[model samples]
Target: MSAAVPPVRKERNNMRARAALMSPALLIIGGFLVAPLFVVLVYSFLTPGTYGGVIWEWTTDAYVQFLFEKDIFDETLIFSTAYLQIYSRSFVQAAASTAICFLIGFPTAYFIATRPAAQRNMWVLLVTVPYWINLLIRTIAMLFLVRDNGPLNHLLLSWGIIDEPIHIAYTNFGVGIGLVYSYLPFMVLPIYATIERFDFRLVEAAFDLYADRWTVLWKIILPLCAPGVIAGSLLVFIPSLGAFIAPDLLGGGKNLMIGNLIAMQFQASRNWPFGAAAAMILMTIVLVTLIFYARRQGRSTVRLH
Candidate 1:
């Protein structure tokens, strides 16, 4: 009689079939994601021509230009005084926006997450409904509201609080407000997803064992919800750092971001290679942040598990 086939043999056969079926996804990711990244890396090393195309000379001038070309910015002060200011300001603004969103979204998500399933869905809907409107429209609407003759100024004037309307339409504060408003929902949903399933019983137990609110939060709640915090920070911070449209429209180009500088390289300056380099540099910064966030979160999850 023929020897009976082993269960392990059959399982291996089935596993092979499953792997074969997943080939399409592997191919798709390779083509779309991997290829584009590979191409961009290649482009970053090429030399930019005067006519906007890249020359395959493998030069680092694009990078050197941005890093060392002080005289280009000396006239208006980008090199001497404002060289580092743009990035510093962007960092501060992005940090503030991330912090604000976290503060607001954490409690909001905590409250929503503890609700009944049906009620929780409704609360989420309320927060997400603003996203149905276009971002540009929202920015423009804010611009309209904060304009000198708009409702806010008119109201202030009617109240006799000031003789003239304050110029607020195109300022850093305006840009920050827009960034926070636009990205708030992004931050909220990620946090809500993780925190919604959060077991507050741990906190209650801590309190029962004589832990105070601060202690409970620091030891129990925060550690439990750190994944959500990391996710929210990545969501808000990455986009806020690269925010161009909001700052351009609301801040009126006065609050130009690194994103705007990258755009100008491509469009205004016709410097493809330099643009690619800037893109790569900005991407590197984002990747570093993401790596940090991921490592922190992975360790937290591992410790929790």
Candidate 2:
């Protein structure tokens, strides 16, 4: 052996090794995620070309166009509420989906978490089975089920639950149902993971201290499991907000959500800049939601400590 390496030299060698280990991930993120985001950001501020792509000329008209429309005759900017309505509808649908997922998923997750360890894997496998199928196939199947003459309506008629077939397909209600079906597992999995590791002793202690079920749920269980609930909510809400398949197939093109709006811009409308702007706005909303969650999580962690 030669003379021993110096401590600083050894540390430098270790850092080089770590960098080599991380280089692949760094390149992948930079190439795939960051570069695309940069392109979108640049395109959002550019003027739309005559045909489809962007012009090098810079302008904020794409963003302004969301809230204001140029009059057909005068070309004067008039306040427009149509885009706002679409955004509102998207948010409402997303929020409804999140709430519905939580309502159904929490109980299901708790049930799964409470089961014996040997059985928990089976329950989880069942929960995830539907997801293994193609989403488009499942959505189309849902459309068939909710259609006027579909089996669901036929069954309802046979049971005398209704005199006529309920119109669910190609409606907002149908969209919501599709969203819930698509993302319910996202809500369940996180909550189940959290509750699996949760200390049930705390719940028992609360009961022993004369806390009622509701009180224990509100004060102890809910608070401790808040991370899972929040995580599940984010999981459900974000995807629902940007959903394309459910809204497209189930909503029947009658209603337009943000995702649909963006798709129309790029494809039907052929306005790249506007599509980029809409995408950027959607990304901003998601980022803000994530940042808010992070800060709230940090504060809660501090409180616990």
Candidate 3:
């Protein structure tokens, strides 16, 4: 005879309780995030009905419009046949923001990570202080500080540099400044996490071997911290790609990043399918980049090992 089977009822009860507890959070995220994403995927492949409804028929019209009929679909692309300007500009802005964030953040992270343990927390807090301020509020504060009659112009006027105020606010330059400022903390935190966990004695050994500082930086420190560089770059670039208020208010309609285009469709044009298609396109681009980054990082790791 088979051994007596243990009761499974108790095990089932435990499983049910766990699922019940997790259900609420799962429901909320699925309802808000996953559901909307699936809807976008569906909208991209389906037709856009009149009065902002989706037709039940399968079609590629929205994606086609994104590629060919850009003017009719995208607001900033109107009155021009340069169909991909918005996509191109968005790429440029995101790339520039990532580069600048890295250049400015790496050293700061290094310093903070190497400081005395007692001082590290204070420096990290100082780096993060700007994040506590509201994004829109911080962006608007920049506008006032750089506006024609603001402190910058006031100072220039006082120093006898120019008789008239310079146009600093409401420009691409202003938008870039805001992007860098808003995203700086994201860049710093990841790199700090990286540099903090570094094996500093390796650099000291490189120094004992009579290696120059630049050589040690290039061959030892940088290669050792490749993960951090990738982490910080991803953190900075992805979010800046979809930054809304910063470019909208600072660029003053002159700059047309992809984020603004997506927002315009939902809010101004009220075309849900087209907006969903645009978003799917942005998602595809981001996915492609991440795949490439991961592949490269994997290859580097293999080489190092």
Once fitted onto the true fold, the runs of candidate 2 whose alpha carbons sit more than 4 angstroms away are 1-3
Supply the global lDDT for candidate 2: 0.94
Clashing residue pairs in candidate 3, if any?
A: none
Tens digit of per-residue lDDT, candidate 1, span 82-185: 42466668878899999999999999988899898889999999999989999999889988998788999999999999899988878888888888988998
For residues 1-305, what per-residue lDDT tens digits would candidate 3 score against the true structure? Answer: 22344558667778899999999999999999899899889977876666666778888867777766544445443334343788887778888998999899999998999999899999999999988889999999988888888999999999999999988788877888889988998888888888889899999999999999999989998888889889989988999988888888888877778888888877777676778898998998999999999999999999999
**How well is each residue in 1-305 modelled by candidate 2, as lDDT tens digits?**
32588888889999999999999999999999999999999999999877899889999999999999888689899999989899889999999999999999999999999999999999999999999899999999999998999999999999999999999999999999999999999999999999999999999999999999999999987888889999999999999999999999999987999999999888879899999999999999899989999999989978987
Query: Largest lDDT belongs to which candidate?
Result: 2
Runs in model 3 lying further than 4 Å from the true structure: 1-33, 49-51, 55-57, 70-83, 160-164
TM-score of each: 0.86, 0.95, 0.85
**Each candidate: RMSD:** 3.5, 1.7, 4.3
After best superposition, candidate 1 residue 273: deviation in angstroms? 0.9
